[model samples]
Target: MCFRKKLWSIVLSAALVLGTAIMPANMIFAASDNESQLQAMAVKSGTLQYGDSFKWTLDSKGTLKITGKGFLYLSLDDLGDIKNDIKKVVIGSGAKEIHFSFWSFSGDASLPKLAEISIPLTTKVLSGSLRECENLSVVTGGKNVEDIQGRVFEGTKWCQSTEHVVLGKTYIAYNGTGKNVVVPEGTVAVSEAAFQSNKTIEAVTLPVSVKKIGSYAFKDCSSLKKIHGGSSVTLIDYDAFLRTPWLDSLNETTMLGKVLMKYKATAKDYTVSEKVTQIYEGAFSKCDNLESVTIKGKITEIPRRAFENCTSLKKITMPNTVTNIAYGAFDHCSALAKISLPSRLKKIETGAFIFCRSLQNVQVNGGKTNTKLQSIEDAAFAGCNNLKTLTIPWGVTTIGDYAYGYTDGGGDENSERDMVQKMMWGDEESVPKLNAANIIGISQSLGHYYAKENGIKFTATKKGSALKKPTVMINNSGELSISKVVGATGYEVYDKSPYDKHWCKAGTVKAPVRKYMTYELKGYKYKVRAYRETSTGGYQYSAFSKIKTTK
Candidate 1:
């Protein structure tokens, strides 16, 4: 049978190239007494049909051959109980189109015995078809099948063989138990479960034409060590390499495709390659030690939850190529003290940078009045307790619910303004210093309008003139004291200690008093600094004071 199939294949190829009218494959059903005789001698025979659209004849040899001309839809359930007994299938060459369904060739235990199937050259196997066929093997024909779905041969012997499985032009599966495997070039996709549950394969190199990797494509390849090439892959389904050993050590991050789906790297300062165009959902979540990220890619949109809960990410460099920041992209990045937004950033989605408690400053290009920034989603900057300076671009139009100016709970309970008021004056009773205020932006448009509507203080620049630096000392009464700078109207004290972390504004002092202003202290090794606040609101400070332990 193999020799005959090969010989016929060569003849068909030769005939096509030479433009000769060759007869179709061996069997051609005809109306005759001989056909009636064969039917009588058959073990089982019947014509299955879906109205007038499709029809097939099931013969004794377990071959469900297409009898209808042009096109036919082969749905497994439509074929009677004999469907389970179909060991081999021969789709007629005359059939131009064949549509398969999820229930077409699935879930029947007897499917394991289906030894071979011959699909027409023009068939289109849709997604979620013929999945989990544990033992059926030897799929032939379909030289022109264009849209073969992932998992079409999953759990089947054809997918588990020690050979690369090529269906039409797509290299869908590789069950080779070698230490190294090289995917054939020109293959467009790597289908789902293509190498699933395998234990021997150590490395696989995908070709560049491969644009998509289906879900769980390499789900449990326990020994998969390296994946090389695949520079052109645009979409990688999450968990494509789940439970694989090579995920965490993927040093060449760009090979994971343009869209980073799951990142388990432990690097402290990760830099995304320029080839990466998008960062997919949960790409870098829960990286506790990640201190900084330099995204130099042309990523237009940061997908949902891309970097959520990365508690140690201190800083991020956004490239101008970023247009839209998606929902929860950088949520809960607790250590991110400051971030610089790109000039072209258009939208900030819901909770994009929410709960970043240590976020103190956000700088965007204030000169870019023609910026694409349109909206700031709900809670986009909420829960940012230490946010001291925010430079809203002039193009920002809409601010969603609790966009900024508020914290975790709504309705003034955790408002950032209240928190700063408490931190600066200890209570609202004491006079407030200028540096305690949040510098709104360099030049504002709608942000100023909204701030006015919401009674939020916003200004294009700091309010006061710059003042001279103040001196820090411990006063005789056992309190931390800040000596007033000569010509300054007031002084702002800050506790800078990595032991407690973050530069927190401690207290404020009015100038012109003879004695140094002081405060009763909570003992901690602190590197304190005093910046003099001008009568107009700008601040100027000397170098940081020496580290001192509170007595």
Candidate 2:
């Protein structure tokens, strides 16, 4: 927000000081060597009027200064086939960037000859109009303008200070090099690839009116430090600020919520807006310094690998409106201390929480239905060396491969296994509801798990086993022998679940379970089946195991 004050002030002053260059009186319109004549630019109301008195020939290339009050319209169709002519056009004060709006009279008349144009800020307009001006340098704003189109100012010098550009609108895209830019109210979008490869960017702000940011819009800016997208911006490009080193020191807060999209190093501390509704892939993929996040309302989906490598995230708060989480959502967050899932989440994708080595606790709420809460994706919690406990919400349908991860092993085959399963119960009533947060929960439980595939730890009520003892269990298999079907490379077991069972090797692989009739210390069950790989690739599966588990 600091950038707005400075940029708008400059825009106001720009209106008053429109000219330092005036037509030199005696100059006349002259023809060029290539049969083109130079004419004066038409300056309009609130815009400085100059070169109007006479025309000047551009036989040589250089910087041209357009001194005007409000706007300047130029026709360059007669510019002919010359590759380039005008090198740069610098506009001076009391002049708003919108006053220089012009249409290309010639086809394909891109950049400098009509190319490198610079429009300094002066007055307040509804939106900054610099569409298709690829060669434009700097575009600042007034307190009034609303949104700007994509790539309006690029390849120009003014946008070089990414930290200072001030903007106030939506649908705008810019180069990374501009000064601090701010998105004001009533704005709607920040298009993709808007600001790519900027070197001098300092900061950017998104007001509540913003909805989305196109991909890579702010990648590679070396100086960008702050991005204020609190409760305003929604969609952020996955790789928007890919390699910016300064993002590490930024102050990210609740504004980032579900709108956050991060990559590599720029993901630190960025917050999502409280009102955000969705989170996509690679959002906050690898930020090491992120500390906390609060999910406020109606977050419907969390895409694959959403929080893949946020090593420094200590805590996360989620509201009750969430329903699904895709694969690898929290994959390598070794430093994450706690996480709480909404009561009604139905699906958790593969590898959703793999490799969270330091997780201490997990809290799950109710709202689970028998069929709806049945499936847990593959590798959901793989490699969690220190996880201690987790509250398994009711109605769980599927617990896939590697549900519980392994430990470092200490290189001993008989090393003492982790005791994480001992603490996985009872978090239903402890998690209190958050205020104005659409059922967000602040306090959380902690748990740690080993890094291997021992599966989740839980005790089943005694039904009747030949022998009684403390036991943890999984599939209840039966002796089965099978052979590959002629045209089939792999096969599947159908317990009537909606998902297609995975193909297994021709030899054998455990059958994926969808229903749990019983649990723990039941006798071992094994079967042999034939299979082949499918076009989707992997071995086929066999029929479901006929045996059941009873404790």
Candidate 3:
């Protein structure tokens, strides 16, 4: 299915190029009356390339024609030489995004001769692609564009003449002088910095169709006191309402629709409401007074810098619904001591828990077969000097560089000197060694590979080895009997009632005693596993036996 989509995209691009090439020569020349002057200049007509995917053509008539199937990459250097001669830009179909490089010098227009542009319906995002085109006046097409990022039409003649510049379903740039504004219906997005630095605007009302509010959308709107109709919004980018009176007026915990946007309360402990389905980046950042946080909602990911710099934070509890912990989610959380990862978590991004000086115990719940964790990215647990041991899950495949047991050497002079030398001369031995003394995981797993590669001692647990699954039976006296396999020092019994969410530890029996008293309640299930004492005094357990229900 994926291959077919790629083939279709390639075929469509070729057709777009062919369509543009077949335009009659007379039609191209008929647009200008000074044909003799155009011919005398000997303007070069060839392909201009940006990146690997985009290619454009400039004709002798000063017409720039853009043809592509994907993103549009524009740079000052790419068009700086011929920018003065290009008067018109015609974007052909199949271009999905447009990005323009910032001006070479502040307040200087790059394309002085550019007067008109035509965007295709395939373009969805226009990220300041035409900004600083001082002479640009006419804009055609782009009736389907969804996002207009960062003052896209700023300083253009077209934007200066229009009060509320909107392209398709996105509210682009706003130039209105009114103190209050109401976005029209059917608009789905308010682009980045759409109303940036507008001091007079005291209130703004959005239609229900708007789903995304871009970064710095209302930044520095000092007089803005109310933002109505945010119940349908699902995504709010970083600092969308920063430095605004509306944001200052909000309560400690600000919820825009289902997303938790900010947490400003000074309380020592806080629990997120269960209704929150998502958390914005830096939602609770720099909260030095916060000691503990409990997330009990349907959020699927912890965004970047969600709780960064919360030095007093010692503990955090998250529900199992979370899958990904983004980069720097818990960075510099010095007081964090322990955390229990969700069973369904898939990836821990780079620097997810970096500089967590007090972090010690990281518990990965669920059995080997149930946990879905896959990768531990670079610096995930770096600077955690107190962490002594970690048990990587069996499902994890990759352990990134410095994912665990790396310190930044804050107070120690020798370690700081070593760090500086390592950076200057690339001295490998000058770098501090892994802080974790012991690492445990299944044999031959990535955990074992990391330990071997780092010269750390590893304790590997062989699956179904001497500590095989114990034989569990219910005797006539209502007691559970377990027949253990060879080389077992003890047996651990677990049971779960029908209403329980997870199995609970029943009891532990030594090698000679294989029987355990059964629970009095009916409809309870039991399972037993054999464990052997390791050389380091840690217990290695075999897989649980087949479950047996009590009558």
Candidate 4:
């Protein structure tokens, strides 16, 4: 994809740039700011005063010169419509420091029409300075100049004007049009958008001294085949080579610094490297056939949308270093059956696990005392219909809307009960902070008057007896039976299938039942699980027991 270059406005104010200063209020000088005076000076004399601090002059050849300055704030917008009249800029030795924060010169295109800039050794161009002059080729006389910012001359026709690689302190651009390019040693960083949209150069070699590759450095380099050196490279920012054909050559791992940028593989099982401390947004998303993932690292947060829409992912083992799960991190993963949240987890952002159709269990640090969990954002567990068991930690003080409930007018009888039946334990005072207006199915069953007073609707009663998860086993006659029930009213039997999400209800077990309830099956050979009722008159169900298969 062709990423558009970022545009920065030239509008500057004294408060926005520095603290307070005595200068013209507007970014570009208007007609009242001596337009006729500047035009007459361009024709007759060559010098004019910009307030009292400095003097600016223009020669017959359209070469502008700025003489004396303590802190010169000369943006291209200061020239306005007269910007195209100037072809060269010369900063004399009298100037001490020059700072330019804007670069977008307005016209048919955004880049400025001027070419060539001559700066003395005493001046310095501050960081975050963007220059997109495409025809500027003569950039010299900077032996004593302070460190220049990267992308100072980016998107310029001078990028291909020389065969030798051009660098600004540590940045690399103007890599030339050669089929093979070699970077010298001792380069520290490649600035953002340095080599953006270059469609040439087949191969390149880098020295071991290079580090830090910036965002979109090699974007749109379609003919570029390979990058030969990245041994010392760390900290490559987002979309460094976004539209490059080289991404197709990456197979097992595409890592830069401690962040795992992208993972593209056909394997069923994948393991993250021990050195990875962060996973960027959308790194492993849309992997349709992944089954197991093992992360053994010091990663602290799962970023936004890190694993969304991975349909076939079933298992993931998170290390204890993880503390925060960002918004939409694992949404729409249809095959994930269960997950053991890290013990040190503190925050679950909005919609972290929404729409996971087969997610049955989430094991966190349970119980009503001193848990690490502090918040669960809106719809964090919404649409997880099969989620049977959960332990809301005591430390949870904030719960967002629809945190563990069904959407209005959505879900079937079993699905609705999936929220209403599950057990929740928390400090009584802290759970009241949950927003009642946005919650429906599950929050209603809690019977917190705060939920009802806030307009939550539910048919089930609040009070209920908690029941333990049951155990199911296949008998010698090939009949499925459930055992080990404490407080029960009835039982719901389910047929387990690998692909199908809906749990097929086989039969029911009423009260005064025997030690074991047997349900004869038309034997094909599949697994079965069951949920035992806990409340007498309320709608409360235990978690599904371990599956038992017919041999």
Candidate 5:
């Protein structure tokens, strides 16, 4: 076994508690040693990188073929930067998956091929690594391999996945994702930026082997919704599930009491597991339908923008163990009237609650923070004219430009009030602050200086908050058509919809403009106007849709 492999063997022992029983005997027996056993499996390929000074990277034009394998690891360390012509890399010819080992491999258009991959137990697969390789597919240690370095297959085809992937304790990297994927047993750490930009993945089933998931590991997987969580999962990366719509599934189901990370389906109630130690930056960014989040864990901190822009959220309860609160963690939670942050909290980053206008009750002391309120990003609360009160925690030092900029709780905020302001978290020990008291305007000048400081809210000069979520309805007019409904955000239509909606749902605030809602109107009158709330704290429906329901 390699030196690093030996270290991992000791680290993730709990994963080993199940014994190699979950794995095939061939995998266990084949793992005797990396050298002598895998040597005879080589099939001779057009490209060969062997031994120290064995020369690195071969020129296979486009399709590089592998005949046999004696542990052939494509050595990229020696081959600086190669051209993109070598697009299709084929690994086959009795090489089983044993030929590859630890290391990062990248070249323009690398083998997007997944035709020849399998676990020792023998799960027949027609295409391995075949999602959005765009033009890439990474293959790593075989089903039997154990304890490989975490980053051995970092950003290659091996890292990209759209479905279930099986790995042994020896397998190293699993940084890829798709809509619905299952991670087999014996896996360990899921490195950082591993699943970045995988937009198609809908569900993920993590194996008990995973102990740590790196930062942004699931970032930008917008459609992701379901997660078959394992109790062994511990460390989670920042923004690990950013922009993922299915995050709420991690929350416990109403009847089931499970954590719903990304909200996407048919469950009515959801809860989070206490074993979770952290909720990274933007852990649930843009998940508009989350009604409530009750974190029951031993978490010590909540990072920046942890729950920012969750418009449909009603409330959240932060665990008592939390200490640090990063900037803009909950800036635009429009409907979030209350939050349960513990009194024992220590620091509050700049603009932590900048635009949380609907935030009616937050129990923070008048002055209790370690750092000054840093520069407030633009529009931190630009459209939040409804914000009524401000309760500054102690120890606050600085304040962002838009720290208290806009004040209207209703109506379209004028351009004058929309202008952003920047206010840095000042370095003052005393939390001397001013509540909206009665002010309601965001100035362009304030946006300038306040946004100048780094880490503060950074809104582009563009009026971004002005846009609202559109509601769409899909009637029987066409074969599965989608039309925008005026006010329906997310519908956890479990059996009424097409695909199975058993996946847990967080909630979607607004339905898209003509997408998938069932309209009950007799005359087919389509009224599509933005839902406006009256000053009395009630909803004032906007003008009807210009065009009636599509005939």
Candidate 6:
């Protein structure tokens, strides 16, 4: 994935440079002989002038034709005095999108003569371009349109006659006066603001085919108390059910299908249920009363700002299934003191734990042997003044700027003062250098580079040993003997067979008794490394010796 991204960036850079060299400045499309003949019969003809992509020609019959590739940029002001003269609009097949400067074609002013529009099959989204055009009655060739946002045709003749406006598989708008509403089958998506601000809607039933509910889909429906039939829904945008009685009625936890939408309760302690597989962004944000949370599920990520401003939250337990800690997931959780990351965690996004002043400890990979962590983005642990030391794993290749203990006066004066008090109170030994924290990891790792670059104190966990590598000898009887090294406390034996993908630990032999034997030694390669016990009860290892096999 990284290689592909780099390759795509290079290709885009080269394409941009080549395009700049070949394209002329202030260039406009020159009309061909056929186009010139067609323009002669037109009432008006001009380029969009914003870009060379679009051109417009209004015929004598009051038909406005738009030809464009990529996008059609239009506005009521773009028409100038000819706004009232347009009766029909035909968009070219090459146009994939239409962007209007204003929300709609007719807003303060009216396009009374505009009655018909023909969108091409290539256009996939219609976003409030012809809304409130009261005279617009006919629409054609929008079979490929998949998304419709805002009130695209609120006052139009086509929308006034229909209660439920569905385009393609998308439910675009609700114009019904009924209290109980049932969305038709085969509808796959509910567009943004589809049922917004409708006071009479008391109940809504979605079809099994509906997979997504856009933001503000059912917002401000005061009387809406029930929503049924969302078994097939996989995605529900934030605030999809905002300001509705149904959402307010959900006490404690609000869940829509497999997604946890909100935590409404004032409880001091909470645990996410295992049934929920996903969590929406900011689900528990600003929950000041929440003190402890235990997440139990197959959730792969903690969404952005999921627990921001949880001032009382001090503890959080995450399951091993979580692999990503998204950007600002725990921002300003001032009381959070310690966190244990999961073994499968890969990346810690920017500002994930920023301004958590009380944070003192962070254990990565759950203190396990192997880690899959790759990167720790900028300011991941910034403003964590209380964090004295952090141990980075060897597998991590990138340690971003200010990922460790860093303090600033960016509206966090109280935290900075607390750190200063600790330093002045003769407890300075527990506090790390200002803006530079103590880091512990294997020698020559990225953690060392980060520490050296930031003037932080670094301690190598696996330092080079003075003891020489132990020699491994295998005889015909498959008895392997490892020659002992001076000043070594023990030797670790590793073996790799033809079928093995990695070297496996065979056994460890104490010093002065280094002779070792294994039954499955035949057709297997073996190596040995000597280690000396450190004062901290850890081992410092020498480089592995040459591989040996039984004759």
Arranged by TM-score, best first: 3, 6, 1, 4, 5, 2
Model 1: ten consecutive residues of lowest lDDT: 426-435
Query: Across residues 1-551, which tens digit of lDDT does each residue of candidate 5 receive?
Result: 99898976764474378766655465454456746545544332334455312222234344444444334444333222442334544444344333233223443323333223333322111112223234344443344444233333444454446333334443233345334666666667554555567777777777777766656767777777666765566556566666666554445222111222333433323355686665545657777667787878887776777678777778677776777677777777778776656756756556576656666554543223222222233334444445554344212322333455344333334432333221222222222222333321121222222333222333332221221323444355521222343443322221112222111121223445323343343333332334332232222222223333434
Encode model 4's per-residue lDDT on 155-201: one tens digit a residue.
Answer: 56655566554443455465566677677666666666666777776
Give the better candidate number (1 or 5) by lDDT. 1
Candidate 6: tens digits of C-alpha lDDT, residues 1-551? 69999987876577578754544443323445547655556678777855337888898678999998886777765776677788898988977766653334335436668888888888876775556467888877877776665557666787665788877777878888999999988888898888989999999998888878888889999999998887777677656777899877766677776788779887899989988877887889999999999998888899889999999999999998888899999998999999999988989998899888889889986664247776788778877778888888766645665577566544466755664455335342444445546888866455665676567898887754456767888877787787878878888787878766446678888887877786654578888877766554334456678898755
Best by TM-score: 3
Residue 215 error, candidate 2, Å: 4.0
The TM-score between candidate 2 and the true structure equals: 0.36
C-alpha RMSD for every candidate: 23.5, 22.0, 20.0, 22.6, 22.5, 21.5
Query: In candidate 3, residue 59 scores what lDDT?
Result: 78
Model 6 misplaced stretches (Cα beyond 4 Å): 1-40, 43-55, 68-84, 94-96, 103-107, 110-112, 128-138, 150-161, 252-254, 263-278, 285-305, 309-332, 337-355, 360-551
Please give the CA lDDT of all the candidate structures: 0.64, 0.47, 0.78, 0.61, 0.45, 0.76
Candidate 4 wrong stretches, greater than 4 Å: 1-100, 103-129, 132-152, 155-165, 253-270, 277-289, 299-309, 315-331, 337-354, 359-551
Q: Best candidate per lDDT, number?
A: 3
Per-model TM-score versus the true fold: 0.45, 0.36, 0.59, 0.45, 0.37, 0.51
Tell me the spans in candidate 3 whose CA falls farther than 4 Å from its real position.
1-57, 68-82, 101-109, 149-151, 154-161, 263-275, 285-300, 308-328, 331-336, 340-351, 354-358, 363-383, 390-551
- Residues 86-146 of candidate 2: C-alpha lDDT, one tens digit per residue: 5555555545434333335552434444445443445343232334344555443344444
Candidates ranked, most accurate by lDDT first: 3, 6, 1, 4, 2, 5
